[model samples]
Target chain A: MSHGVHDTAQARFAPGARVRVKPGRPERIAPMHLRTPHYVRGREGVVARALGRFPNPEDLAFGRPGEPRILYHVEFDQPPVWGEGEVGDTVLIEIFEHWLEEA
Target chain B: MAGTPLPESVELLDKLVAALKRRGVLVEEDIARCQTQAERAQPETGARMVARAWLDPEFRALMLRDGTAAAEAFGVAMAGAPPLGVLEDTDRLHHLVVCTLCSCYPRAVIGYPPHWYKSAAYRARAVREPRAVLAEFGTVLPAGVQVRVVDSTADYRWMVLPTRPAGTEGWSEEQLAAIVTRDCLVGVTLPVAENARIAA
Candidate 1:
């Protein structure tokens, strides 16, 4: 196991894995280290493109050069995301592959 | 701004400003300058690079790849600006920029970041809930395009090079730069009016 920055994070990779946020509660099993912005979280969108092999930010920020992980560009609907009657705009985030699963 | 910070040393600075204001040692205009309006003089080098890139695509790629290097390619010396990065907007991904901590902006390209860039509302909301933030800016993306909120922190500052709007193919570089407003380049708003200056 590469001692990268994301080493402390649990469940490095698995699609459609049941995941839940710790929600300031440390005891719960948090499947993915969530990087999805609070706005688009839970708002469903398809995976547009998977950008592979990028340094995990948890490591990159601290200068820990660990193994590269898969990154995905996740897209969400504008209306569904912002709610109805709002100007429609899709939201996309660059998330590590480990954070996602078969929804 | 990301370097080691000594405690809240800024409290001392603020107290000094308040004292000066009480004594009428400084005028409102002076305070404005020291507060915000007194940013580093706009780097002419960056302005010229923006104008040049409006005319050339090869230069555009270079700007995206090595931001500082590309600026110098057009004789724009990036002396005062902090290390800068260019984030390009594409058909699938739309970029919205913010500096959550302090205003770490790409002075080499679009000049000082707007006031909204540093507002607490913008900072707290941008990274937390991007969809709501973009709505505040009045930019509704197409049904399929995804909005990616890139935070410009102390170490890495970002500038959004908006996709060149259509209907300006035959326009000159000078004409194009006129449309590239500071807000547009920052990705807070879209470039409008083929040849008109972006409304401040």
Candidate 2:
């Protein structure tokens, strides 16, 4: 049910906004083409930049027009992406609008 | 075994292509054309882009701002492919790109992904232990430089714009590009000036 925010070509959550990956769909039971990695699910990060409107790859893979979604470059710290000491390393993952919520 | 067995995914692709062919949506010529195009998609385009960017700050800004446009400036076709994202390597930060889910690379600019890049080990360990991965590739970074791993998860493909090695001030673009290998753009290794290598 966490899929109704991307109404505009350029939807909510701009760059520099703190956001968390949404754990919307259950991956194990059904066949889904998801771009959000499980390691980042429900984790917090900052939006590095908006990558303009793109058809949801999940839908495109299934041969659908996939109503455009705003894609953003989300940057996460290395600690939560994995359990490790502070290495000062960070990760940047491209996530669609529907998979993210303003933190 | 004669060779490694193809995964079920390969069979699925075959089935999909067959279905499309049956429906007249795909043809043999299309596949041949694709193969030809794939042959042309080498890392040389990316290397030339990096070399030009190293010498021209304006091109570097354009590359960072709009990677597809920069690639197009090099005459690489950018018709239906996804946008490109160029991550710059600075004195304090290094970028290593991985597709955790699958191998999604900037094929238009940098050719196909390497075998190791698509392996499950690289995909998993790159995010979990990037520093270790770089070291295995013989890239030992100083402690001060931060390691940044980029996951090419969605629509935009990623490549690294490596820093120019010192002592190449008067080098031509072709000479500069000659040192930029596919691994350098992949962020596993760096382009070292021959003099620096010899001196070290």
Q: What TM-score do all the candidates reach, one by one?
A: 0.54, 0.88
Best by lDDT: 2
Q: Which candidate's DockQ is highest?
A: 2
lDDT of 1 by residue, B1-200 (tens): 22455557778777887899899898668767654622543534443455566678888778776676775575544665444566778777678876554566776555555667767888777755676777787866667766666654323346677776777677777666777666766676776664464343
- Give the Cα error of residue B13 in candidate 1, in Å: 5.2
Q: What is the interface RMSD of each candidate, in Å?
A: 6.4, 3.3
Question: How much is the lDDT of residue B37 in candidate 2?
Answer: 88
As for model 1, its CA RMSD to the true structure in angstroms is 9.5
Q: What range of 10 consecutive residues in model 2 chain A has the weakest lDDT sum?
A: A1-10
Instruction: Evaluate residue A21 in candidate 1 and report its C-alpha lDDT on the 0 to 100 scale.
Output: 19
Chain A TM value for model 1: 0.56
| Per-residue lDDT over B81-169 for candidate 2, one digit per residue giving the tens place of the 0 to 100 score | 87888999999999999999889998998887788989888998998899889989999987799888999998888889998998788
Best by TM-score: 2
TM-scores for chain B, listed for all candidates: 0.70, 0.88
